[model samples]
Structures are given as C-alpha cells and as structure tokens.
Target: MATHLDLEEQEQLDQIKHFWNKWGTLITTVLVIVLGGFAAWNGYQYWQNRQGMQASALGSAVEAAVNSGDKARIDQAFGDLRSNYGGTLQAAHAGLLVAKAASDKGQMDDAKAALTWVADNASDDGLKATARIRLAAVLLGSQSYDEALKQLDAKMPTEFDAVVADHQGDIYLAKGDKAKAIEAYRTAYQKTAPGVEYRNVISVKLNALGEDVK
Candidate 1:
C-alpha cells in the first residue's frame, strides 16, 4: 500500500511539471503585459495631475495680470498659458478673461487673438461656442461682417443654440439683412427659456424686424 501511494504521488507531481512546462512562459507573458499596462495607466494619470496643477498656477498668474491692468504682463502670461496648457480647460477660461481685459484696454487685435485661440482650442464645447460668439461680436465691432458671420456659423452646443441664434440675428441686422435677421430672431425667440429677460429681448428684436412672435 505504501509503495502504491508513493507511485501515485510521483505521477501527480510529474503531471503538474508537464503542465507548467507547457504554459509557464505564456502565463508569465500575459501577467507582464497586464502589469505593464496598469503601470502605464498610472503614469499617465500622474502626468495629467501634474499638468493640471501647472495650468492652475499659470491661470492664477493671468488673473493677477488682468487685475493689475497691466496689458503687457497680461499678454505675456496669456501667451504662456496658451502655449503650455492649451489642452486644459483652465487655459480656455483664462483666455476669455485675457480677451476681455484686452478689449477693455482697446487692444482689439490682442483680444481677437485670445478669443480665436479659445474658439479653436477650448476643451469644452460650450466654452468654444461662447468664444465664437464673443469673437463674432468683436469682429462685428470691427465691421468684419463676413468674418463675424463665419464665426457665428460654427457648430454650437445645444445649450448655446438660442444665444448663437440671437448673435446671428444681431450680425444679420448689422449687415442690413433684415429678412435673415427676423428669421434668426424668431428662431432665438422660440429657443429661449420661457419668461427669461433674453426671451423678451428676442421678442423686441422680432418686433423691430416687423415679425410678430406670438
């Protein structure tokens, strides 16, 4: 009986060895791949966190410059933010602030440049749409009617559709296209939130264009 038990145990050991011989390398390879992928993901997350911190710091610098009313410092800090952290949403928000400051300082070209950057590169769709609308307004002020219309024609997020239409109405009115202006005003009126002041403004625009909005 002891001899028989010994032989059976030896056979089981041999079977396990054979199985390992066949699959050890494959199992090791799979584990290595999975672990490497997990490590890479962690590394990427770490890098993103570092980037976010840096971007937030630069954004603060931009705000400081804007507050100081220092046009040159604002321009420099904004350029740095755009160059280094353009992928971050903070960059877009900072760009908008810079554009507003530049516009207030009569730096029309600088304002347009800042707004163009946000319109083209903002991470958020709504931010991009807002940038486009503001940029269009700037262009309209400059009498760049065609360019203003082009900016307004960019795809807007659903939440911004009404505002974009209102801006389009303004652009059309500026261009003396009263028919298109009325149409855009009507669209805005239909899209605006019920009982909002903007809705009332749209109603006024429609009335001005001789289009009754019931």
Candidate 2:
C-alpha cells in the first residue's frame, strides 16, 4: 500500500512539471507585460503632476510681476513663461494679463506683441477671439483702420460673430467709410438677439447710421 501511495505522489509531481514545461515561458511573459504597463502608467502620472506644479509656479510669478506695476518685469516674466510653458492655459491668461498691463503703461509695442502671441497660440477659440478683438482695439486706437479690420476678419467663435461685426463697423466708421460701416452695423443688428443689452447697443449704432432692424 505504501509503495502504491509513493507511485501516486510521484505521478502527481510529474504532471505538474509537464504543465510548467509547456506554459512557464508564456506565464512569465504575460506577467512582465502587465507589470511593465503598470510601471509606465505610474511614470506618466508622475510626469503630469510635475508639469502642472511647474506651470502653476511660473504663472504665479507672472501674476506677481503684473500686480507690481512693473512693465519690464511683466515682459520678462511673461517671456519666460511663454518660452517654457506656452501650451498651458496659464500661459494664455498670463499673456493677456501682460498685454493689458503693458497697454495701461502705454507700451503699445509690448502690448501688441503679447496680444499677438495669445491670439496666435491660445488653445481655446474664445481666448483667441478675445485677443484678436483687443488687438484690433489697440490698432484702431493708433488709426490703423485697415490693420484693425484685418484682425477682425479672422474667424471668430460663434458667440463672437456679432461682436466682431460691430467692431468692424467701428473700424469702418473710424476710417470714414460710412457705407461699409452701415452695412456692418446692419449685420450686427440682425445677428444680435432681441432684448439683449448688446442688441440695444447695436440698435443705437444702427440708428446713428440712419437704419433700423427688428
């Protein structure tokens, strides 16, 4: 009986060895792939966290410079932020802030440069549209009517179409093109929603041009 039990145990051991010999390499490969994937995911998460922290730090620096009322500091800090983290939303906001501060300080060149960068590089259409409008205002203030109109001609977000048309009307009026300005104001008046305060403003502009729209 003991001899029979020994034979049964040996037979079980041999069966396990046969299974291992057939599938051991496959099992090891599967484990390596799963573990490696987990490691890569962890590494990616760490990298994203690090980038967010770095971008936030740089944004804080720009905000500080802007608040200090130092135009040169705003320019320098924004340049650094743009060079290193231009793809971040922080960079977009910083660019706009720097532009506004530069404009307030009468640094038109710096303001234009910063607004241009934001207009060209902002990831969101809304932000890009805002930058273009502000840039057009700056150009219009300098009596560059054609250049301001050129900026306004770029594609705008749906919500900004009416606003852009109105701005174009302002540029045309500034350039003494009453016909085009009237046409633009008419378009703005038509596109705006009824009873909206903006629609009232457009109505005022259109009435000044000797036209009315429902």
Candidate 3:
C-alpha cells in the first residue's frame, strides 16, 4: 500500500513538472506583466497622494494670504499651486479664493487673471463652470460685453444653467441689448429651481423688460 501511495505522489509531481515544462515561460511572463501593472498602479496612487498633500498645503497658504489681505502673498501662493498641483481640486478652490480676495481689494486685473486660470485649467467641470461665471461677471464689470458673452458660452453643469443664463442676461443688459436681456432673463426664470429665492430676482428683471411671468 505504501509503495502504491509513493507511486501516486511521484506521478502527481511528474505531472506538475511536465506542465511547468510546457508553460513555465508563458506563465512567468503573464505573472510579470500583472505584477508590473500592480506596481505601476501603486506608484501612481502614491504620486497622487503626494500631489494632493502639496496642493492642500499651498491652498492653506493662499487662504491665509487672503485672510490677511496680502495680495502679493496670494499671488505667489496661487502661482505655486497652479504650477505644481493644477490637477487637484484644491488648486481650483484656491484660485477662486485668490480671485475673490483680489476683486475685493479692487485689483480687478489680478482677479480676472486668477479666474481665467481656473476657467482654463481646473480639473473639475463644475469648478470650470464656476470660474467661467465669475470671469463673465468680471468682464461685464469691465464693460467687455463680447468677452463676457464668450465666457458664458462655455458649457456649464446642469445645476449652473440657471445662474449662467442669469449672468448672460446681466451681460446683455450691460450691453444695452434689452431684448436679448429679457429673453435670457426669461430663460433663467424658467430654468431656475422651483422655490429658489433668486428666481424672484429673475422675475423682476423679466417684468422690468415687459415680460410678465404669471
């Protein structure tokens, strides 16, 4: 019985060796490819984490600069964030904060520059849309009606459609195109979420243009 068992084990070992002889190179190649992909994925994850940390630190610096009303610091921090971590959401958020701070400090050009960076380089679609809206507002304030309209022409997330339309209305009004302004206002009024407080403002604009919303 022991002899029979030994023979059976030997046969199993022989079968495994034969299988390896037939396919060892192919199996090793496949395993190496799979393991290499796993290593690459892990390396990418590590790189992303490092980038995120760097962006977060820069974002904090930008926030501090904005809080202190230090325009120069804000500009420097924003530039670093944009250059090093533009792919991160924190970069876009920091840009918006820097833009708002600059705008509040009466630095319209600086504000517009920051907003333009966000509009052009933000990784998130929603952030880009927000940047476009803000940039349009700045352009409108500067009386650059065509440029404002172009900013508004960029695609926005669905949640931003009403606001974008309203901004377009403002741009048209600034341009003295009351008819187009009224059309835009009406579209904004219709698209705005029901019961939104801002819809009343849109209604007023439309009403002022002789387009009653009953």
Candidate 4:
C-alpha cells in the first residue's frame, strides 16, 4: 500500500513538471508584456502632468508680460514658451497675445511673425484659422494685397468660412477688382449666420458694393 501511494504522488509531480516545461516561457513572456505596458502607461501619464504644470507656469509669465506692455519681456517669455511647450494650448494663447500686443504697438513685422507661427503650428484648428485671418489683416494693412490673398487662401474651419470670405472680399477690393469683391462679399453674406453681428457687417459691405444679398 505504501509503494502504491508513493507512485501516485510521483506521477502527479511529474505531470506538473511537464506542464511547466511546456508553457513556462510563454507565460513569462505574456506577464512581462502586460507589466511593461502598464509601466509605460503610467510613465506617459506622469509626463503629461509635468508638461501641463510647466506650460501653466510659462503661460502666466507670458500673460503678465503682455499686460505690463513690456515688449522685450513679452518676447522673451513667449519665445521660451514656444521653444519648450509649443504643443500646449498655453503656447498658442501666447502667440495670439504677442501678435495682438505687437500689432497694437505698430510692430507689423513682429505681429506677422507671431501670427504666422500660430497659423502654422497651433494644434487647434480654430486658433489656426484665427491666426491666418489676423495675419492677413496685418498684410492688408501693409498693402501686401497678394500676400493677404495668399494667407486667406488656406483651408479654414467651417465656422470661419464666412469670415474668410469677408477677408477675400476686402483683399479683392483693395486690388481694385470690384466684380470679384462683390461676389466674395455676397458669399460672406450668404454663409454668415442670421442675427450674428457679422452678418450685419457683411450686409453693410454688400450695400457698399451696390449688391443686394439674395
């Protein structure tokens, strides 16, 4: 009876050993992959948090400089933010603020530079469209009519179509193409949302061109 029990125990042990020998490496590999993926995900989360905090700090610095009207400090702060955190929303906002401040100070070149950066590199589509529109306006102010038209030619978000059309009308008018200007203004009028202040403005533009918005 003792020998029979011993043989049964040994057989069970051998079965377990066989199973481990067959599947051990695959199990280990699966566990390693899962654990590595978990670690990578945690690392990514921590990195994103660090980026957000740093971006927030830099954004505040840029805003303070803008409010103080310190052109040099604004440029420095924005430069740092763009260099280090260009992918963040904070950087995009800084670009817009810098452009506005520079434009207000009659620094057309600086304004164009800032707006061009935002138009090209901003992650938000709306912000990109806004930057392009503002840049076109700056070019228009300098009588760079062809350049203004080029800026307005880029694809824009759907919400900005009317505003872009309005800018096109202004550019064509500046170029003395009254027919094209009227056509562009009519497109702006038709695309603008009714009751929006922009529609009223477009109506005024159309009236100035002696065209009725159909």
TM-score of each: 0.94, 0.82, 0.93, 0.92
Per-candidate Cα RMSD to the true structure, in Å, reads 1.5, 3.1, 1.6, 1.8
Cα lDDT, model 4, residue 180: 96
Off by over 4 Å in 1: 1-5
Could you give the candidate ranking by TM-score, starting with the highest? 1, 3, 4, 2
By summed lDDT, the worst window of 10 consecutive residues in model 3 runs over 69-78
lDDT of candidate 1 over 6-98, digit per residue (tens) = 999999999999999999999999999999999999999999999999999999999999999987788788889889899899999999999
Clashes of each: 0, 0, 0, 0
Q: Give Cα distance to truth, residue 11, candidate 4, Å.
A: 4.3
Best by TM-score: 1
Model 4, span 42-84: residue lDDT tens:
9999999999899989999999998999888988899999999
lDDT of 2 by residue, 1-214 (tens): 9999999999999999999999999999999999999999999999878877888888898999889887677767888888888888888988898889889989898899999999999888889999999999999999988889999989988889888999999999998999999899888877888878998898888888888665
Clashing pairs in 1: none
Number of the candidate with higher lDDT, 1 or 4: 4
Every candidate's lDDT:
0.91, 0.89, 0.91, 0.93
Best by lDDT: 4
Ranking by lDDT: 4, 1, 3, 2
